[model samples]
Target: MELKVLYFGMIAEVTGCNEEIILLEPNSNVDQLENLLKDKYQNLQHLSFKVAIDKEISANDTLLNPNNEIALLPPFSGG
Candidate 1:
């Protein structure tokens, strides 16, 4: 399965791109994708971020699918 992943703020800096497509095995979950990213992009392993699925914040156990849109967002600050 392939999912579209969006990167924001510092996460984008670490990834060196605003978005990309990640291919995963069938039935993969958020945790698996996170681990794969950490290995693929070493900088991500040391950065702090949140995962969102189809525009909703999700947990590590959240199941993933080819149709779901994923995003990695850095901490936000605003008044």
Candidate 2:
């Protein structure tokens, strides 16, 4: 399955791009994707971020599909 992934803030800096297309195995979950990304981007392993599925923040390992829009959002800061 192919999905669109958006990177934000520090995550984007680590990834060196704001968004990209990722191909994953069928029935892949958020945890699996996270691990895959961590493997691809070694810098990501030390950073903390939240995974958003289709614009909503997801806390669990949600199943992903080809049409799913995923976002890697870094910690927020308020002035």
Candidate 3:
């Protein structure tokens, strides 16, 4: 399955980009994707973030589909 991912705040800095299209295995969930991304970019493991499924932040291993729009977000900040 293929999914569109957006990175926000520090996540975008770590990844060096804002958006990406990922090809994932069928039935892959947040945890699996997290691990996969961590493996691909070891620096990502050092930062804390949440996985948003279609704009909703989730901590559970929610199932993802090709059409799903996902995002990696760091804690928001305001001055």
Candidate 4:
């Protein structure tokens, strides 16, 4: 299964992009997927963010379906 991930704000800086597509196995959990990405991009460690599966925030154990639109939303600050 493949899902499109979107990076926002500072998250994009670490990843060097606004979005990318990630492919996962049928039984892959969100945590496993995050680990893969962290391993691939060393800079990701310095950032804080949340993952949303199909516009809904998902936990580390959330299972992703094929073509699900996953988003990596970084923290925002405005005052």
TM-score of each: 0.93, 0.92, 0.89, 0.85
Question: Who is ahead in TM-score, 2 or 4?
Answer: 2
lDDT-better candidate, 2 vs 4: 2
Task: Show the colliding residue pairs in model 2.
Answer: none
Q: Which lDDT value does model 1 have at 43?
A: 89
**Candidate 3, residues 1-79: lDDT per residue as tens digits?**
8888888898999888999887789988999989988887799999989999888887667999888779998977699
Better lDDT candidate (3, 4): 3
* Weakest lDDT window of 10 consecutive positions for candidate 3: 52-61
Question: lDDT for each of the candidates?
Answer: 0.92, 0.92, 0.88, 0.83
| Candidate with the greatest TM-score versus the true structure | 1
Question: Residue 7 lDDT in model 1?
Answer: 91
Better of 1 and 3 by TM-score: 1
| CA lDDT, candidate 1, residue 9 | 95
- Expressed as tens digits, the lDDT of each residue in 1-79 for candidate 4 is 7777888888888888998888777888889888888888888877788888888889999887776788888876699
**lDDT computed for candidate 3:** 0.88
Model 2: per-residue Cα lDDT over 1-79, one tens digit each:
8889999999999999999999899999999999999999999999999999989998657999888889999998799
Off by over 4 Å in 4: 77-79
